[model samples]
Target: SIWCLKSKNVPTSGCTFYTRHFLCFSVDSPSRQDDEHKLIARYTTRLPLTLILHIINFDANKQKRELIAQLESKNREILAEIKRLRAEHDAVCQPSPEKGSTNPTLLAELRLLRQRKDELEQRMSSLQESRRELMVQLEGLMKLLKDEEQRQAVSSYPFLGNTETVGFSPY
Candidate 1:
């Protein structure tokens, strides 16, 4: 069984774990170093422990499925917007009955529509750039996810030291 300080017979009532830059494991140990059993490393990012558990269960297939779903949804929206813009462009391009009339208002409307088209084109370009960056990020995450899956598989047996990758490596 486990041991604690409240009494030689008393075991840890319970424990809680959290994640930041590194995982933190707090137990009810009444050791001399820490009478309260509280041990927190240097502060860093505050990623919840629940998210870590989710990452623990991820597989390569799941990643692919989620990426595909996102792309499908994004493509549908883009297609719809492109269709709408094309209709607007066509309307502006159409020849009016007053072809010889020098109407300032018509010219202004045409200019405004052209400006809208330029804005749409710029947005599309940025979206494409964002997609490329996301793909790169996804690739890096996949490698880390695969490694985590392997570690979970290996820990089927008892671990000698801390199973948590919290401290520095020996090598």
Candidate 2:
């Protein structure tokens, strides 16, 4: 059993006090102690620190998937915009009987369209680089987390023998 206490004012006499009791268990009983120890051992063996690392890895994988989807959507949008711009430029460049010549305004608009397309291409390249960097970082973090979990598992179970003495250096 476990008990919890909550109070607004701090105790000044260096004496501890308990309030708002939630649970009470008799730890004086040897049977209870044995049961608690058995429970701890069972739980630790079945779900060790490695489980935490697995959960983190799963989350990272999910994020990567989401990022890929977003990147694809963005690329589609950029492509559509470029197509629309090209159509508009073509419409402006159509020959007019009144002028029967290339208009300066149409030429400037075409130049602007080309500039926008180039900018979009540069942005796409940057996004690709960012995605690659994120993946590399995620891989490194997972590896470090795995190594830490293995170290924790070995430390938790003493009966498995001293990992360091056995030449099993986690580092």
Candidate 3:
């Protein structure tokens, strides 16, 4: 929904609904029109601040969730890749006893495969480290998301999460 704007290239239609609502009023009775205008003005002044804040917070929460999901998916893919790499490395590094006995070139090829296997192991270690770091970051972000959600829930009571130091406590 955020990707597609309803008003494309229409240079900032400032509050289209309010504009339409404003246009519908009758000007035949000047006093009543003035009262209606005042009411609409009050609504215009008060609505956007709270509404926009809520929308912003909600959007931010959704984006964080999306990022976490993407990271989790990538982590899973990396795990699968690591598994494949391990299998390939094992196959290459552990040649059968009978296979390399007669052929000198096979011995040479086995040496090269072992080197490639070492490189693959190194790469796998790095990916594993990266996965660990990503998991930590994901956990921290999830905690933050939960805290933010709780804060929003009890926003009416601003002091809910705070500790009261009443009647002089010794630290």
lDDT, candidate 2, 46-106, per-residue tens = 5657886888899999999999999999999999999999998886576565544457786
Per-residue lDDT tens digits for candidate 1, residues 82-122, read 99999989876775768525677877887999999999999
TM-scores for the candidates? 0.33, 0.38, 0.35
lDDT ranking from best candidate downward: 2, 3, 1
What are the Cα lDDT values of the candidates?
0.62, 0.70, 0.68
lDDT score for residue 169 of model 2: 55
lDDT score of residue 93 within candidate 1: 77
Span of 10 residues, lowest total lDDT, candidate 1: 15-24
Candidate 2 vs candidate 3, TM-score winner: 2
**Model 2 alpha-carbon drift over 4 Å, by segment:** 1-101, 162-171
Best by lDDT: 2
> Candidate 2 has what TM-score?
0.38
Which residue pairs collide in model 3, if any? none
Give per-residue CA lDDT, model 3, range 44-74, as digits (tens): 5655687868988999999999999999999
Against the true structure, candidate 1 has what lDDT? 0.62
Error of 1 at 14 (Å): 99
